[model samples]
Structures are given as structure tokens and as C-alpha cells.
Target: MTNGIRVSVVAPVYNAGPFLHAFVNSFLIQTLPGDSIELIAVNDGSTDDSAAILDDFAREHQNVHVIHQENSGWPGKPRNVGLAAARGDYVFFADPDDEFGGPEALERLADFADEHASDVVVPKMVPRGDRLYAQWRYETTQIDADLVTCFTTLTPQKLFRREFLLDQDIRFPEEKVRLEDGQFLSLAYLKASRVSILNGYDFYVIIHHPQQDHLSAKPVDPANYIGSVAVMAENVEKYCTDPDTGDRIINEIYFRKVLANFTNSRVATHSLERRQAWQRQQKWFIDRFITTSRFEKMDEIAQVRTDLARDGDLDAIVAYARAGSVDFTFVSARSKRGNIELAGKLSGGFSDGELPKLVVIDRNDKSRIVTIPIQLAKSQVTVQIPKETLPLMEGARRYDLWLSPGRGHQNRRIEGPDRPFSLHFTDDRDVELYSTKKGNLSIAVSRGMSTQARTKRKLKRIIGR
Candidate 1:
């Protein structure tokens, strides 16, 4: 019988001094049996006062121990160090910036662990704010699977049997510079049994630090993500049941991990060469997955565009549109002439040629212009953005969506319309549209365009003064 399971919560600290206190305190707030729950705080060579922070906590509480290590090149090495130090039979990994769903959730999860004798127990997530939706990786509904569901999407949401991890020789790839959380899960899931899932507990408070995207600032290289994705793809190909299943499994991993390079690029502070290198590296990595045929999927395009944009590739947008990454639709009523406009009698297109690549998004399909290029000799030109490219924005912080145009650094700045307005391009060609809310609401225009001023004013009106 599984001796009363020892629940060890693994908190990996690296320059986590800012949020270290509450993260540690969240555990202290839990209701688990005092002896049953353990906190293994790994201070992975934090240059900040993070080690001191953990040290302070460890001093206050015996469960919160710290493992000081050298400055490793990757996040996984420190986690591996922590894994060795984890004394509990079940290990719970937590990021210092995030928090548990609730104080009692861990206790409940531990109880569930005792009841099912599960190798992996997954918890759910709920959105913590306006711009962000909770990400639980696994499905919210009750799911029980040995390979697909258990071993696949639900990797991050579980409490793993430490022995199973050690027995299988499962270790976080120390070489991986990023996304190993997924890699770690994929590795362990294959050997797991009785993967139980628990709802009602959002075990982690994944913070969306808007100011910190690689686009807006420095980030670990996207190439590191490539290495991580490569590891996952190899693992998936080796362990999955069949070619189809393996493809799908690895496809999802490829989608998320590789897409990370792009997403991180989006957060970069400027269009620097370093960011471009990441994008280039990402493009190279994506080259592998693109041939998988699934790249043709709209979600695939969406993922690619996101990665590209994150990598700060404005040109990636052309690829995004060409790949049919934009899936938004328009409800346009056109004039006898080629001119196109919106439904509200506002901004209309002069010609089909005037309708540059545009994608219009709104609460409904009744949008005016979504920024998809369709040659309108004044005819309405519109298209849809794939669901992936325009993810729902609920709790993003400090988004720097600058949309100025022409080309390169010379594009003029253009904010989105003042309000959600309809279109009336030239004549009877009037329609309505909305832009996606997932990123910055700015757009740019070229000085070559004569109507740029009118376009900017109309947008200001549409976006609301």
C-alpha cells in the first residue's frame, strides 16, 4: 500500500525575490496534515536576495528548505537539483511568481492522491483577471486516460509520484533553456498509471507580466525553445502508440513549445537583431513542423504567426495571412463600383486595391475592416483571423502593440478606431469590422498613402475619442 503519501511542494527560486514571500506563505496557508505536506524550496543560484528570502522562510518553517546552486544556463538544471532534494513521495512543482488556487486545494489534492493512488493528479485553473483566461492545459471535464489524456495535455497540472519519476530515470532536461515544464511532463506521463484529475482547484497563479515579453525586453533566446521542442518531439515519437497518435501528440507539443519562441518574441521591447535571431531560429525550427501537413491547419498558422510576431517579425504577418492565419469574416454591402465601406457608413475603401491585407474582428462577424489585404477597386475586402492568432486577451500587462506603417521603421502611427464603427468605403460598399484584442491596438500607415490622415481620424473616431 502507498504509505500515507508524502506531498512535497517544489518551489524553484531564481531571482524570485519579488514574489517569494507570498508564494511561500501560500503554502503555509494550506490545510494539509502537518507531517504529510512538505515544501522543498530550491534556490537555484539566484543573484538577488531570493536565496536569502528562501533562507529566511526555511528559518521560519522547517518545510521550506533551500538548495543554493551556481548560476545555471537553464531553468531545468535548478529544478533537477530541487528534484533530488524533494523528500516527499509526491512532488508538486510551483513557480515562484505563481500561487496555488486556494489554501485548501493542496490538502484536497493530497487526499485525492491517497484515495486514487494516482501516479499523476491534475488541478484546474481559473482566470485571475480581465485580460487573461486561466490555462489548465488539461480539460476541465472529468477525464481518465492512460496515454492520450493523462499523458498528453494534462502534464503540467499534476502531482507526480516521485518514485515513478526516479524509477523511470525521468529528469528535467538540464540542457533545455525553456519549455521543459512540458518536456518534463511528457517524459513522466508515459510511465504513469492511474492519472487522476481534480477540478475546483487552480493550483497555480500564472502571472502575465506584460512589461516583460521578449519583444518589450530581453528574454532567454528563442533558440533555447527550439532545443526544448526538439526534445519533446523526439520523446513523443519514441513513446506514443501509433504514427497518427504520435503525430497528434507531438503536434500539440510542437505547437505549444515552438510557438513559445514566437510568443516570447512578441514581448520583446524592440526590433533588435537579437529578437530577430530568435525569430529566425524559430522559423528554422518551425520549418520542421511545417512539413508535417498539420502546419496547414488554421490553428497552425495562428500558432506560427504568434511565434513570428513574438519574435518581432512584422514580415511574419504576410506569412500569417498567406497561411490563412486570419480567419475573420466580413459582412460587407458593396456599391456598384469597386469601392468598399463598412456597415456604419464610416471608413469605406476607395478600390479593391485600397483594401490592403486586413483582418476585422468584433463581438460578432459584423465588422468593418480587420486589416486583411483584398484588392478593392473599392469593393469590400475582408477576411478572418484564425482563432490562434487572436487569442482572447483577459489579463495582459503592458502590451506594446505599435501599428505604424509604410514599411520598416518609417510607418506612421495609427491607433485603432475610437469606437467599434461600421464602414462606408466609397459608395454603397459599406460594412463593419473590429480588430483583434489580443495585442497592441496600434496600426501604422505609409506617407505614400494620401488618405492616411482620414484613415487615422476615422480610426480615432471608431476607437472612440
Candidate 2:
């Protein structure tokens, strides 16, 4: 009750004793002042010392509440137990195996929710072992009053209004063993007065365990997921009174849940029973709408384009890239310097004034672009190097063009940055780029050069003897 709104966090546990201390301690350590955060944990009959850890935390901190429940194979039951005891004005749910990326994640969400008058605020979820989420303006947060109306398919990354949950009786379908997260969220948003989407700036570190479906060792359970999705579709069609909204949600359940998952992991070797289950379930969903030329044309074109641009081809990729629109704005720190103008077809080159961000990071420094997407077809683009970009080379090695999103990360490289400092007329269509720290250039992709031949060529070019 620090700011007069109670934030009740509910975490469920099975055999998560190994992570229990870290999870609870992190939540308790950075707690805000009074009227702020309180935690409620349900130790769902964990086979290990999970209950002991929860009890210890509760004993130590008055704000911690622990509930013990019998071993229930039902995945949704533990969540239900935790949700029942949450007394805060707003509630957040976490699995015992997963914990917060930063102590400040909740505080930031609270502040954003208050400022925007939002009922649900989602934080960006980043997985473990990768770079954390980047900060962005909260004005980027999007919202929809009806759950079915959200254009984005991003799943539960939110803090929910407790009252909103209770009033709508938003509880999990314990009967359905799988896809409970999808099922619960779909219903909650159905009754939500206002749902807000916060951009991905917060991180949640999820530790994969064998027992969890995400890291399951058992055979696939498409049947259970089909049940979960069917429930969602039925709820939307029956309860969501808006026709267009219903159709959109229906489409999302098909595309985002079923098809998208299929693309990611559903394989050909699943048991025939499970495959048949998925197809039978899909038929019920397909009956919701008739095929139309509008959607069909777009789908057909997307399929054709994807087929033509299969992942294996690179030159066809380069040709496709050499066709994107580009903008080349230039600035220089030095005036009246060697005039840097468009050399030829690449007219978008920068004028002599200052260096671009790309050049500054690409110099003989310890830097490269990371996590950039690669696509085909680059339009005309040009860049001019500013003297400022070339920091004094001390033991500098090589220059690199790293295509992070590509198969082989090092797309191009230039060894030793003394000459040919220019990386112009680049084929950018096949890549997305955001620079990281710069260091000695290390261009691994050779433009077909051998050590002896290169030395002779350099001798000829340098001496002109």
C-alpha cells in the first residue's frame, strides 16, 4: 500500500526449490514503501524443499504469504491457488522457475499504468542469454478496450487489474490441461475495460525444466493445445458481441497459435491421433468464415513470394535487395575538406561535413551490428566517411560487415583499415543493421585474394615502378 494501490504478485511452485530463494529474495529485496508490493506464493505440492523455502520467506517477511495445496497434476490448478490469495488492487502472476530480470520492472509498470490510466500494462519479455530489452517511449504502448480487438499477437506480458479479474470470474479452465495461458488471457481481455500493451523493455528470465511443456521430453500434445484453442474460439464467437472483432480474434487463434506454432515446431512425426485431432479441431474453426478473394489474393502472393525467396538462395536475394529505397544524409566535422560526393550510381553518399553513425561504429574499434534482420533487395544508398570516425588506429586489425540475421554472421570483411576505408555501394536489402561497439576491422569475407597475389598487387599499386 505504498502508493495506495496494492500490487499483489502470485507465484506458483512445483519442484522449484532450487530457484525459490532467488525468486522470492529478489521480489522482497527491492520492495517499495508501504501501500506498495506484497507477494502471495502457492507451493503446489512440490516434491522437494520448495515448501520449506516458501515457508522460510513468509516467516521472515510479513509481506510474504504462503499457501500449501495438495499435489495436483493439473497445470492450471496451481495458478488458480495463487490467484485466489492475491489481495492487491493489481495482480501479476509468475511461474516459480522464472523470475524478474530487474527489481525495477514492477515499479516502472506501476508508474506507467498510473500515468496512462491503463488497467493492464505489459512489459517487454526477454529470454535468458540474450541482450536485455531496450528502453523506448511509453507513448509507444498501445491499447484496446476489448481483448479481441488487439492487432498485435504478443501474449501475456502484463499486470492485470484484480477487480477486473474477480468481476469477470476470470479463472483458468482447469479441465483443459494445456494452453491454459492462452485460454486465461483470452477470457480476461474479453471482459477487460481497458487493455494496454507496454513495449518490450523489461526482461523475464525463464529457466526451462523437463516437466514443463516448453521443454517437454514426452511426445507432442497437439490434442491438448487443440482443446485450449477451441475453447478460446468458442468463447470469442459466443461472448464477444462484435462481429468484426470476433472474426479478427478467430483469425489470430488460427494464425498466431496454430499455424505459427506449426511453423516453429510441429513436426511430421507426431502420433497420428494427435495430427488427426488438430485437423478435426481446425475444421470447426474454419467453418466460422467463408473464403474470399481479398484475403486469398494476399495469402497467395505472400506464399508465392516466400517460395521464390526460399532461404537457400543468395544472389537472387542480392538482386532482390538491390532494389530497395534508401536515404543518405551526411555531415562532416571538417569543412572545405576533400569533397566527398556520390561516386556514381550510389548518389546518396554523404557530403563532406561529418561522419554517419555507421562509420563511427565501424572504424578500428571493438564493434559490430547485432540482431539486425536481413531481407532481399537493397535500393541505392551511399555513405561518406568523416575523419572523426577513424579513431587513431593503435594495433588495429580488420574491418567487418556482420550480418547478424544471416546464416554466416560475417557477411563481408576488410582486413586492416588503412586503405579502402570506404564500404560503399553495399547490398543492404538483404540485411537489417543496428551497430554495436567498434574495434579493429576484421573482414572475413575475402573478395577472392591470396596472400602472395595480394602482396604483389599491393606492391604494383603502391610503387608504380
Candidate 3:
């Protein structure tokens, strides 16, 4: 039955009493017409006032639908139930702890999907807490986004054509499994004919409650988690037709899920036995998915740690993780004759033959690398960006700065200066150096209004001339 609802929001609720009111209200006041949107709240055996709250909303609002199901431990089963009961053209999966980015979020997503006939519409997601989302991918609206590059975002907080999902038999894994979202999204991305990315407006906000521990934050058994990741990798291998695309997908998994574990501070704190067990499990996926060619393309630190893990060198891995910590501080920056100079201090334990190199990475296009001359002395490192190089980087763009430990060592991001430092060039282009929330140093270049230009505009406004 084709109802008037254009979008069905499926939220699996479990003991979300504290956040229920705000989450439900976020939907109730949506800019989308009340008749065009429906909220499917599936109470997965929540032993709190969650069920009562949902019932109250259902009684008050015609668009709110409530479903009761037994506890499923994970969100998979309840989400599947909500999916089965959705009666709208498009479906969006949301977590009860989080809420829509804005009231107009749903309306914009549905309109974009309809205009472009997008089977999957990925909206801009902003993190409310310390959680970090890949904001680079959502910098601009892409009508036809590539799945290979956009593979990092595997969350289910996206708008999907319900008919497309049904025709493809794509459903969340019902069992209590980690990376279920990865498995489901991989299939959807592979089968989706048209995928659109809406980045102009924030559509989804991921809120991190201080008192509540998110499902992903819970302690995970390394073996069990790796097993789930293996399943997700297998799905990509099975459905992905192109070998190159399959390799990229698997490599991403290996880098993020496998190698990144060794770098985590918790690994060093774990007992030797536990660390060894984690490495052994990681090696299985590394052998199957991580190819030498793709492996070489990873950052130097990732390469070293992954090799150690593959060899099952538990002692070496622990020692390397402990000794690999590097700290960088921005000391000074200046601009003269269209040239920009940055000076920073590196303080950390470095290997015997390790040398420091400045790494400039383009935030917009990560693949592009811009190299400039760097001088590394005892503890201070200086970089000189020639005027010629500025032309190649001409645009309103942000570039991330990093300090690499020579050729075969880890790269540490430079961090410092709470306040941003601005400098103007001869051509009136402005350069600003600032620290990211994570405290990494980055440079922003733009053709902004000069001080003189701003003063003139202000005077014109005051004089009414």
C-alpha cells in the first residue's frame, strides 16, 4: 500500500529513557510534512520508561508507530523488524541516542534522492562528542559518488530506497554480530545503481552521551570482532566484480580494523597473552586481504606495525608501540613574497637512523601530495614553501601538516598554537594556520578580503556614501 509517507525512520530503541524525549521531538518537529514522514520506534525489550514514552508518542502522533520485540542484545534484529514494517518510499536508520541534524534534514534528503533517482543518499553527519567522522567526504555534494572511495563511511545512517533494498534482498545480519553495518552497507553500495552524497547541510548528528556507553564502546573480544570483519570482507569479495575494487575494500578494512589496533594505547596495557591472541587473529585477515602492492601504499608506521603483527612478534610489537610515540609543537610561522615558512619542534624517541621529513597532505584530495624543502636539525625542523609551490596549491583549501620519521618510520601530526596565525601575501591572498580539534596543525589558504578592503567597506556602510 502506497501511503502518503515519503520517508520511514527506523530506530531500534533499548533503554534510551534519558535521550528518548529529545530524539522523538527531533522527528516530531521536522520540516517535512507530518503526513510525509513516519517514525518507526522498535522497542527491543527496553526495561525502562522507553516503551511508555514510545506508546505516548504513538497515541499523540499519527505518524509515530511502535513495535515491541524481545531483547536481541544487538540492534540487528530490531532494525530488521523495523525494516520489515516500514511503509514509505525511502527508509532511514537512526540510533535512539542520536537525532536528526536539523528539522529540514529529512525533507532535503528525500528531495535530493527523488531529483537524482538515487538508490542511496548519504547525508552530512556531524559528531557531537569526541567521535570523529570523515568530514572530507562530505565537503561537497556529489551527484554520483564512487563507492570505492566512500567505503570508509559504513554506518546505516543513510537514506535508502526501500524498494531497492527489498529487490536486492539486503537486510541487516540478524545475529548478534559486530560490523553488521559494514556487511549490510557493502552489499548496498555494490548493488546501488545511483548513489548521491548531500554535503551542503548537516543531516545527521551523532551524539555521545557522557553517562551512557554506546554499543560500539563496549569491550569486544578480539577473536569475535575479527570474525565479524572477516564476514564483511568475504561479502565484498563475493559481490564485488572488479578485482581492483575488491582489493581496495579489503585493504581499507585491514588498515582500519587490523593494523590500527596495534597503535591503540590499550594494546600496550593488555597482558602479553591477550596481545598475542589479538595479533594472531589479525594475521588471518592480513594474509587473506592485505596484498603487498596495496600494503606498500600505507603510511610508514602502518607498514611496520602490520609486518610485525604478521610475523607474530608480540615482544617487538609491544616495544615498537611504546617507543613510537612522537610529539610535535608548532613554534613559529611567517609569510614573505608569497612564500610560507613553518618551524616546529619534534620531541620523541626516534630510532638510530631516523630522519624527519615534512609531509603536506591536501585535505580535499587525499591522494595529492605537495612536497617542499625541509631542514631538520637536532630538535627543530624548518619547512620553506616556495612561491612557485603556492600556485600549485592555489585555492580555498586546507592542508594537513605532518612530521614523518624519515623513510621507514611513523608520521606524527604537528600540533600547537590554540589561536590561529594569519598572514597576507603580496597578491592579497590570506593564509591562516590553526589547530584542529584533535590538535593537529593545518593551513588554510584563501583569497579573502584584505584589512584595507574591510575598512573601506565598513566606512562606506557608516557614511552611507
Candidate 4:
């Protein structure tokens, strides 16, 4: 029982002295009543002033409790200790370096969980500044799909009912496991009876700094990287029994996340020798878990990236990583003579000589290639989403933006910096631009104009001129 407490926030403190003030202050100032909230601060043998900070907070605030232990080198042990000591109805895991997004965040999350009797509550997490994550498309308060679909974000910040977690015995792996949050949360989703979400509001703020253990500037150890994936693979079978669902979670969810984060992006930054070692170690894990059919089911980019790593092709991985970070900005879109004309500029060291082509990747991951005209100026290109694509875009409500450099089958899918352009029928008369769920930058366009009407308007303006 929670003994009338509403929420318990667990934060693991190591060498986070620099960020402790902002982090602790945010929790203390929450809109939720101080007495109704319990703050479990675990001081994992921090070498800095973190222990003092936690002690001071515990002394001042009746709701705050400090637990000190020897350094475990990772967040898992501290989290498990905090969970065991938690007394609130719902438990929330917060990183010591990250701050609460707003005062109302805790209030909102607690209310939602209590009202719905939710076993799990997911609140929107916003990255500080221009940083981004692989965001989800949770349109409504409740996700229509399976909980496994929301596994893209494995951070353990969401609110989970204390009784539910205890009953299910969902605890983080102790001490030494990397990707422990992923392993713990995956099982949490599978076991949760009901899950609720708080959307369109920022509940948590993630601070990305170079010194953080998870986001260290140095290259990841190839053996440790492989070990993490192996643990996740083992847990997938341990938790999920349905053949299809387990396969999808392993192939579609876990594999994709690993490939995107480690293989495609982080590993590309490693030294050539390290990269080779990483690829070799990864193949062993991939061989045990990934089947040919499952690999084929992946999207083209994922398939290409995985195959390149498996085959020991470092050149393609390097090209893909560099090309993928190319910056493309949408300048303007107009319905020109029944064609959706789009113009954009490419920067971030991408040269027009690369022969970049704009591609509209639909929900099925099938792309409709649009021809790019010769640069009007250096690194600027104009292309059209032909009339045929309008129907596909209209149906899917979204389309990803990708640039393929050069021509032919050899062209690799290089993504842009911005979120994909979205289309929604604002009303019967017009199509509107809806940014992705993460609230990307607003794109301006003529409101209340359908494609047909916009085309007509463009033609009339041309004729009048």
C-alpha cells in the first residue's frame, strides 16, 4: 500500500553534482502536494558532492529519503534499491541529470494513473534544445496498438503502479547490465494490464551532455555492446511467449533500435579497427536471434545497414552514416499544375555533386522517388511529389523525408535533420500540415486550400500575371 502517497520519484545519483540542484529543485517545486509525493534519492557512492546534496534534501523535506551505497558503476542497482524502498502508489524513475519539464507534470501523471487505474502511465519526454529521439505517434490519450509498439523509447521514466510492478516482479537487472532499462521496461509493457498516456504536455526533460555514462564521447566497447544485445535477446524469449509477437519485438523493435543507435550511428564514429571488432561481435548475436526472413521484413534502410555490418562492409556504413546526417530544410510547397512542388536546400557538407534525390517513404516503407532538378544555386534543388503521391500521402497522414544521393540501385537512403512533412485534411476543403508527435517546427502554407483548389489558384495567378 502507498499509505496515501500518490507518486514516488526514484533518481539514481552518482557523479551528478553539477546537475543535482536543478534536478532536485524541479521535483521539490512540483504542483503535486509535497506530502503526497515521495522522493527516493539513492546516492550510489558518488565521488562528488552528490551525497551531501541528497542528505541536505532529506533533512529538509519530510517526503525525501536518501539511501547511500557503494558505486555499482551503472544505474540498475540504485534503481532497484529505490524501487524496494518506494511507498507511493505509482513509481517514476528520473535521471539525476534530467529536470522535470513543468510543475504540473507530476500532478497530471498522478491524476491520470489514479483515475484510469492504469498499470502504466507514459508522459511525453522532451529533449533539451535541438536534440531529438525516435518519437512515437500516439495520437490519442490511449494507444490503439499493443504496448509493445511503444517500445521505441526504453527509458524508465514513465509512471508504473507500485502494486503492478511488485506483483509482476518487474525489476531492473542488478549492477552490471547495460541496456537494463530496455530489458526491464520491455517486460513491464508485456505485463501491464492497462496503459495510459499524457500527451501534448512535456513531463520530463532529458539533458544530453558528453560526460554522462550512457552518452560518453568515447567509442563503445564492442564486446560490451554485443553483450547488451544478447541480454535483450534472451529476455525477449523469457518474457514474450507468443511466437509472432515475440518475433516482431525481437526483429522489428529490439533489432531496429540497436541498429539505429549503435550499429548505424554510434559504431560509425568508432576507429576502423574498433568498428571491425564491433561488427564481428555483433554478427554472433545476430546469427543466434535474427533469421533471414526476419531480416527481410525490415525496412530498406535497416536491411541495408544490417547487411553491410554482417558482410564486413565498412565503406557503406561510413557513407550511410555521413550521408544520413545531411541537413535538408523544406523551403516552400506549392500545388503547381496538379503536382505538389517542393523546394529545399541541403547543407551539412552535402554537395550537389552527390546528386541528391528527394524520396517520399510511405507507411509501408515503400518509396516514390521524385526527380531533382539541377541546382538553382549551390546545394539547392527543387522536386515535385507527383500527382500520384498525393493520394498515398492523404491516406497515410504522414510521409518520411529521405534523400538518396546519386542515381541507380546503389543510392543509399540518407535522412534529413528535420521531422518528415505530414498531411492531414484540416477540413473537407483543405489539407493542413501537422508536425510529428514531438512538436517539430511549424511549416507555413496557404491555409484552407486543397490540392485541386491550390492548383487552380496557382494557374489563375499565372494566367493573370
RMSD of each: 11.8, 12.9, 6.4, 7.0
lDDT of 4 at 396: 28
Writing each residue's lDDT as its tens digit, candidate 3 over 1-465 gives 259889999999999999998999999989988998999999999998999999999999999999998899888888889999999999999999998989999999999999999999989999997667778888878899866666788899999999999999999998877888988888888889988889888899998788875778877778888887787788888887877777777777767776656653766668877887788888887887677876866777667777888899887777666555555578899986578888877665454355456778878888967766466777677788765544434568888987765544567787757899998876667788898998888888888776788789999999995
> What TM-scores do the predictions have?
0.62, 0.61, 0.80, 0.73
In model 4, what are the clashing residue pairs, if there are any? none
- Candidate 4 differs from the real structure by a C-alpha RMSD in angstroms, to one decimal, of 7.0
TM-score-better candidate, 1 vs 3: 3
Write model 2 residue lDDT over 1-465, tens digit each, in one string. Answer: 333646788876778877788788767655465347878887768788888888888888888888898877655777787777777777887767777767777777676666776767666665553323333323356754445435243344468877778888888766635667777877766666667767655545555544444423454365566567777877777777776677667665655454332321242334445545554554444444323421343343233323323332333323222221122222111211421222112222222232122222343445633222211224433334332333223343343432111221112221223322232112111111222243333321112334566678999999996
lDDT of predicted model 1: 0.56
* Candidate of highest lDDT: 3
lDDT of 1 by residue, 253-274 (tens): 6555555433322433435565
Q: What overall lDDT goes with each candidate model?
A: 0.56, 0.53, 0.82, 0.70
In model 1, state the lDDT of residue 151. 41
Per candidate, the number of residue pairs that clash is: 94, 36, 0, 0
Which candidate number maximizes TM-score?
3
Model 2 lDDT, full chain set: 0.53
